[model samples]
Target: MTTQENVRRVLDWAVAEIGVPGIVAEVKDGDQTWFASAGVADIRTGAARRPGEYLHTGSSGKAFTAAVLLSLEAEGRLSLEDTVNTRLPGVLGTNGYDGDKITIRHLLSNTGGLFPTGLAPEVSHRYATRSGILEHRFDTFTTEELLRIAVSQPPVGAPGDRFEYANGGFHLAGAIIEKITGNTYAEEVDRRVIQPLGLTHTRVRPLDDTGYPAPHPRAYSTLFLKDGADPSTVTPENWESLMEEPGQPPLDVTEFNTSLAWSAGNVVSTTGDMIHFVDSMVTGSLLPPAQHRQLWTTVSTEGSYWMPHARYGLGMFEFDKQATGGRTLRGVGGSLWGTWFLAVGTPDDQHTIAVHTNTEWKSWDLMFKLIEAEFGVAIGA
Candidate 1:
């Protein structure tokens, strides 16, 4: 069988065994590109997943935010060592923590130890449940509000000491970008990365965009609230109901506001655009020497999520070769309301695989299998 056929076989198996409604996967190996999709993008219309549909990639956008910051550093607008106090004084660490202790480097590396922010767990859990996202799909929030929710809590670890994924750090990074350039994160990303890269379909969701742009698939998930429970009656004690029901039909969650994540997880793009971004990023062609070093210098994440011994450098992740049979892959991966994505390639940008699914609820091993199929290296040995 052809290599493309074999890849399709793997995707089909994943759809059947993993039980996601639909998926779009693209692979770039040298000059050859293979694209495949299965199931339906919109169950209501039975629309097949397309190759060009956009998806809301969650934390994966962190890499893009980091790249934009590196670009700013290349321009001498800021330094990685600049502390939170330097950029936005009196705005961080209101919960008995010190903003002076955190640096831009620490935030990019996710070692800032800024509290995870109340919205982090709350949104994560809410999205995980079937209809939880529907509760406030149209609600809008400011970046300042999200940051306040985060700093309202104490630090998770000392600055630069340990790895703790804090979305607030990226939000603060966005704030710092605004402070330095006098532009919003969305505006900066457009000027630096999106427009220059010719990513026409890619965009940073504006604070008021409660719905996704057209030519996209509809996303679905289980309700976060209990069966027949009123959305208005939700309470912290029953918030655990946000867990997805294994055998229930998914509710449509395609339309929802993304400002809750702001610079941290609010970028939307297609599989092809993501692969292009990853290629430019890993090859060191995206930034200058000093800023490039900041992009690659990594610290251990100690097996966060599905990646074993993963190291985060800036906004990207470096999956260790030792854990993957001596073949290292670098990029980022995460899920959102109606999307789950993983993009990783060799450091030289010669080979790459990018996949997007319309559903976030699935077995973690499903992603690992997709990686192994595309890159010929199994994760976790």
Candidate 2:
């Protein structure tokens, strides 16, 4: 069977079994590329999802922020060993936070012990619960506000102490990028990665911008309801309640202002663009030798907010023989509202898979199924 057909089978199963609104999977192996989708983009119109449509990529944008910083480092604009205080002194040291103790490398790998801002349960619950998203959906927030929210909470650990997945680290990274380059995080990313690579379809959603570019799927999200009240109890009328269930028909989040996610999770792109981006990242074509090697240097994340045996590098995850049986997979995975996207490939850049689902409620089986179907490699067996 063709790879497209095979991926369609999996997408079909994901829709039927997981009850998601839609799914899109793109595979790039050598010279061949496959794009497959199942389910609908709009529930009211029952519009079919198309291949070229962009979706909210959530924290996958973390990789972009990391790349921009690494590029700056390559030009001797900064150093990974530079402590946060050296560049943006006193910005993150308030409330028991010591910026001097946290290195850029620690921040990139999420070991800087800074409290998480966007990923904090309280921030997540605030939007998904009592207020729902309507109140804040259009609100624009500054990156420094996000940093303040994170530092208000006690530090999670000492610098380089643990492998917690914190969006605050990337936010800090973005802030530093701004300090050094005098350009916005999105601007740097565009100049360094998107424009250079000719990724015409990739874009960083602006803080004040709502809605997507033309020919994009409407994103849906239930925010952090997944860990709350039972799904069956959730009804359309009370969907905005704090006790609201997790997976009621997802609300249309397509046009929500992405500023709340800042430099951490506000990228939109197509599978084709993602494939090329992943290929570039895995091959070190966009990074200098020193930065490239630093990108792969990792620390154990087995007990962090990731799968078993997973290791974290600067801004991506590394799954090697232990995590992926015998092969290696390095990439980023992100979810926001009701959408999810994951892009991973081997160290040698021989194979790559980029998959997106319109609903974030799918189970872990979806990942293993995709890997097994695409690469014939059983992960977590």
Q: Candidate 2: list runs displaced more than 4 Å.
A: 1-4, 119-122, 224-247
CA lDDT of each candidate? 0.78, 0.78
lDDT of 2 by residue, 1-381 (tens): 855676778889987887778888888888877677888887788898887877778888988988999999889999998999999888876878888899889888989987656445446545654245767777777886777766766787899888877777888888999999998888999999999999999989877888877677767665545445543344334435634465565677776777767777788898889888888888888888888889989898765545565788888878756757778788888887767999988757458999888766457788878877887777767
Clashing pairs in 1: 117-150, 129-222, 130-222, 130-223, 131-222, 131-223, 131-224, 132-224
Pairs clashing within candidate 2: 221-337, 221-338, 338-360
